[model samples]
Target chain A: MFLALVSGNPWLESLARLAIIAVLVPVTVIILTWVERKVIGRLQMRLGPMRVGPYGTLQGVADTIKLLTKEDVRPQTADRWVFELAPFVIVVPVFMAVVAIPFTADLFIQNLTLGVFYFVAVSGLSIVGFVMAGWGSDNKYALLGGVRAAAQLISYEIPLVMAIVAVAMLSQSLNLAVIVGAQEDTPNIAFQSLAFLIFAIAGLAELYRQPFDIPVAESEVVGGPFVEYSGIRWSMFQLGEFVNLVLISILGSLIFLGGWQWPWSVFDESVPVVAQIAMMAVKTAAFILFFMWMRASLPRLRIDQMMSFCWQLLLPFALLQIIINGLVLVYDWPNEILIPLSGAGAAGAVYLTYRAARATGVRYQPGYQTVGSVL
Target chain B: MTYEEVIFYVVAVPTVVGAIGVVTARNVVHSALFLILSLLSVAGIFILLSAEFLAIVQVLIYGGAVTILVLFAMMLTRVRDMPAALDGPQRPFAALAAGAFMVVSIFSMVSTEWPGDTNKINVISIQQIGNDLFTTWAVPFEVASLVLMVALLGAIVLARGEEGE
Candidate 1:
């Protein structure tokens, strides 16, 4: 029956892609967990994992096995069905997002015409899952965390989408491969640097990482919406978060860095597919490491502070970046002019925002002793 | 069955089921979730029709944003705590009205001609849609933005209450 339903080429191809992605993402997530711990550990001067495998490289695998075997506990007050469903909702979207990401020049699952748009639109749905998890738990802490996460997601999404819009406009196409192709002369980082910054920063906030990690703030909400989840369910949420981190890095590389394209054609089209994949890996790793650095270094923002940062600071800058991009597009500015102009504009915007905030008695500085003193 | 028919049946069944569940569910959260399911299946139908852009927009807006917003509002209020509040006194009348509307709409849809070539489908690109929005529908688009701005300002005013003074 199945054989009759699907014929030779497309079916096999699609199935192969699906199987690869299904296996690849979870394995990638496991590796990311290890990388994040080790990198952050080094930054903080600690040994991350030393018992599981070589330098604790297999810690993630051990953790997974442990999670699988542990008791799956549910809160007595929790809405059982919604609680069970939320993890799937969170995880599925993260996995599906990989469908649109161009792994290399030619190696993508489905090259939809509206690839970037589809990726953004699909990725946005994870917030709904987070909210569901939070609400379903029926705990005050979980509810607060869920609501905070939802609000944060909604706020950060605007700047993230706008930044992508700048990239889409410049590329004159929404397809990820086409966007990569358009950067043959120079990557978007040279021209749409501000958009890249907004996208990356907002992307981090969207991922709910450090400095914007209020949603799952351990000191406050006790892991937020996932507080009630245990064992496999908790693992699902953890896997989703890590997958999202990788997805964001891959997206950043594809949109801003010349994806799978070595600078100055150190290796051109004649180069093997292996090299192209390696280049992509290198670029994506750079982003992942950068995110880890930020996580290790930055302090978490207060919820109010985070909200204000998005609405007041990032939103305006994102809008201004769009206007500047539109102006450049209208005048048909060459890369030579656009590059320096946008770079300076980005630097000036950052400085001006700092100056404006200072004038308004808003401190850029975090109070090192205040948090402990207040506690 | 053909591929299209198979897909249509698969999507349509859940869509109808989800729509029914939306009104019938006792829990408001469950109803909101049902609405999301209905919206998602509708997006699936849009994909079958090859309206990819419309399908994604449906998922992104209705499934992601609107459903979450509704759920958020429910969470914020005391509504979730009172499951009975989701039900109303006018259930029979509402059901009757909905049934009548659905019957009439389906009858009309089946009976009347759509007044276009049913076979020669136009799969429009996102670029064309953007161009048309800016050039052909420019006034209407700007007017929509203005309306949204007015609503936003009204929201701010209402939120401030008498404190703005």
Candidate 2:
């Protein structure tokens, strides 16, 4: 059983999974252009791109071919290795999440001992790549974007961690699979509903969509860290950005939604693998659309406003949820009772926090919000 | 060495080289990078030790976050050229002392008896950790929150305040 394998050298097993992910991430990146166009087409009430082959699918491939054939240009004043390496830096964690994601009942790439913890910890790595890309490019806009990104990622990352920890408190473990299994064991949606909600909101921010996309504030920073990049290199950065979005959406599905686990076994036999893959892909696609929808709908939050939301609104709610989760688990409370109670408590906490912030009108800067916004 | 040992040795070579580079690299940025390499190698070693949590945290925290922070500090400060060679007069003696100390420690560890054979039995499940964390290590868990609070303060001070300079 997985229990045994994970109990065994889970670290080694997870490393192997991560290695495979390194290979798969690029392929997934390539396919995502097609997926994005298809989804956006339907969203915009258009048939989407129906040229350059069947369903316009070959469009992404054609684009890739063009990028490959294009010249690799660098600014005369740029950090060469960091410039070239920035794409991989962004792409690396795109795959690291796969290690914790359980596709099938037992098909997690790497079931780390601390899946939730690792997810929280390692997800921040992408910020470095962002900063590196900015500084390495030696462009002012790139530098500003990089700083904003580092601020945004680190600031939002706190709420994200707090949200994940709420789930961990409910599950009483840091493992991602354990969290999912814990959900399955109960009416997971009911008990951890608050945590799930916080996670979704925070996850969206982490993905740099909508309100939190100020880091990539193209209007202000001029395409951010990737301003100076061109041709294939530019394409690599662009491709990686789109892929990271998909990857983050997939992560939301795996963590907040029950990854690849369907309660009703509609397709019980014969085509289990295909069914599972379909379900996962469909769920991931749904979340990806959600990302796009938010991007289209929500206006970007001011840097200070975004910081306040994460620090004031999200973090407190998440911490309180964690406490309530812990109490529920410790007291052996039933879901029917705790579900509404947790929901009320979460809402109450949010209302109180907002009221307090409004009363104070203490405008918080993103850099200052991290520690100062304790409730 | 058997095949497994050989594999471990080969895997460890990068770690060893990187660790040395972390200490001795001329450029601060290069040193920071070498330190990342060393940290990643340590994560690999943790995998070898069957410590998945430790390994992932090693990568997630050290590789991802801390390395970025270091790089951020570098960029914010804008230290392009490294310091001039600052070899001390007693450098060789210090190296010898450190080497001897490491040898003695290794010798003692080799001679000493260990309780659990990490290679033989692996029981590092989330359940097991949960059972113990809430039971015996509960206090430590609470203390970690305080540490994190302090870290928050420290990061703010270092990143923003003039004291950081």
Identify the leading candidate in terms of TM-score.
1
- DockQ (Cα-based) per candidate? 0.48, 0.40
Specify the poorest-scoring 10-residue window by lDDT in model 2 chain A. Answer: A366-375
Flag clash pairs in model 2.
none
Which pairs, if any, clash in model 1?
none
lDDT of model 2, residue B4: 64
CA shift of A208, model 1, Å? 0.4
For model 2 chain B, the run of ten residues with the poorest summed lDDT: B78-87
What is candidate 1's CAPRI-style docking category based on DockQ?
acceptable
Candidate 2 positional error at B26, Å: 3.4
Q: Which candidate tops lDDT?
A: 1
Model 2 — TM-score against the truth? 0.79
iRMS, candidate 1, in Å: value is 5.4
What is the TM-score of each predicted model, taking all chains together?
Answer: 0.93, 0.79
Cα lDDT tens digits, model 2, A59-121, are 888888888888878898887776888877776765565566666667767566577676666
